[model samples]
Target: MIDDRILVKNVLAGDMQAFRLLIRQHEKLVAHMIGRLVKKDEEREELCQDVFLRVHEKLGEFSFQSKLSTWIATIAYRYAINHLRKQKIRFADLPDEESFTKHFIEETDPESIVEEGDTDAFVLKLVDELPPQYKTVLTLYHVEGMTYPEICEVTQMPEGTVKNYLFRARNLLKEKVKKYLGKEELL
Candidate 1:
């Protein structure tokens, strides 16, 4: 694994390879964040590329105050959220928070199902049903292995809100699991 500290140093020193190395190291994280936030499937990759491009541009401003992945993830989250907002407006109209709304009806991916078993896949399908705030917190904590403070940094959510969303998201998943197991009585 490439050390982000060293990679950032090399990147700052005008090493293109180090820049690419940084992107390669954090690509999955970027993809996961963009995938959940951006509504349009076709635009996902382009938006991810845009996030990395911005990261490259702002590399010099990185204070190393946080983990490089966390900083990169913050960039990815902002880019995706902005892209989602842009989708709700026309070229003549600039988006504002008031105009932004999440309207995408979450869909379960058939591809998420597996031959061996489907419990894990089903759980993920239910996770997709959560509101973006809930989903974002859940993913940042569970999938990205980020702590509450780290998630707060990435999403600009309060630490309390992060814990609330994580707790709520887990309860929701548990309830869904009960339903899927035909154990409504337990729930």
Candidate 2:
């Protein structure tokens, strides 16, 4: 396998095969990120294409200051945010920060535990319920395992803001998972 940097250099030097190799290597990761952020199947497909297209267009600007994955992730993050902004969804329509916590405290029944076969689907559902910002932070940090500094670079937010976002996102997820498992017995 060619090193990612070599693949990038080859692509930059007009090797179309190198570009294809790069996409094949990272397509799954890109698809997963796009899938989590864009709820609609149709929109997700389109957004995934847009992300790769943007990556190709911007490839010449990549300075190798970060990992290729980090650069691709930044493009994916920006595309997702732009899509959300164009949708004009009100943040208030999303469950508020307090309500998410309250749901954890109020909802709990043994029957509510995520069934073994449904864990992924259930978690995805819960993630879809988060506001755009929290969803972005949660997916990038937890799902992708990017560090806070990487996330800050991807989202163009301060390191402190990235930490706070991750903190709040995890807390919200904990509440969601607790509610899924039954709030009363989670303790």
Candidate 3:
């Protein structure tokens, strides 16, 4: 694996191949974040391109305090959020813990998300209904396999908030899964 510092240095020196390497390394993370937050298929591609464009423009300012991927993720997250705001998409406020837990317990099972053979699609459909913050946090932490601190850095959220979001998001998904599959022992 290439070291981040060397890769960054190479890109800064105007090496187009090195820049492509940077994009290749971090594109999945950017795509995962944008995929979770941006619903429009057409806008997803433009938003991803915009993210890398910004990353290229801002490469010189990166302090390297966090991992390169974490920094790139931050850019993607902010860019997607800004795009949503521009589109007048409203993010719902998080409910209180007690109310949230109660609501989930009483929530009805959703319509079948896919054929019975496709559990992954079912789970993804459940995730798609989540609030954007929950979806972003869940995707960053789980899909991208980022650590809590890395997630916090990417989202600019506090460690406590990140943990709370992750916990609540997971609980929400677990409840949804249990309801869908009628499995009581899922955890």
Candidate 4:
């Protein structure tokens, strides 16, 4: 794997291949961040392209204080949030855990559960229903394997908030899955 500094330097020196390499390295990070935040199918691809465009435009300003992927994630997050605002999407806060758990389990039909029976996908669907903040923290930390500090940098949340979000998000998911399994057993 190429070192980030060297790759960034190469790209800055007008190497098209290195620019492509940069995209290849960070595209999934951008996609994962944007994918969790943006729900519209038609807008996703265009949003991703716009993210890379911003990255390209701002490449020279990166001071390397954070990992390139983290920086890129920050950009993707900002773009998604802006897009959401443009569409007037509300950024919902996570409901109270007890109420959310109760509602989530109750809202699912057995047929719907069985039809989308894969446990991982089912868990992801539940994750998708979470507030944008929870989903972003969960995806960055768990899915992208970023450390808490990295997530903090990406979301611009304080360490305490990032940790709090992670804890709450995990607990919420656990409760939902437990209730889901219990209902699954009864059926």
Clashing pairs in 2: 108-183
Looking at model 3, which ten-residue stretch has the lowest summed lDDT?
A: 108-117
Cα lDDT tens digits for candidate 3, 70-134: 99999999989889889888655557767766666566455555446677776787788777899
- Can you give the lDDT of residue 6 in candidate 2? 91
Worst 10 residues of 4 by lDDT: 178-187
lDDT of 4 by residue, 102-166 (tens): 77666754346546667667778888877789899999998899999898888889999999988
* Residue 134 miss distance in model 4 (angstroms): 0.7
**Could you tell which candidate, 2 or 4, scores higher by TM-score?**
4
The local distance difference test score of each candidate is: 0.77, 0.76, 0.85, 0.84
TM-score winner among the candidates?
Answer: 4
Error of 1 at 14 (Å): 1.8
**Candidate 3 global lDDT:** 0.85
Error of 4 at 64 (Å): 0.8
Name the regions of candidate 1 deviating beyond 4 angstroms.
89-116, 183-187
Model 1, 1-187: lDDT tens digits are 9777789989989999998888889999999898876657779989899999999999999988999999999999888778766776322242342222221222333333533477667567677766677778888888999988899999998899789878877776665555445566644
Candidates 3 and 4 compared: the better one by lDDT is: 3
lDDT of 1 at 9: 89
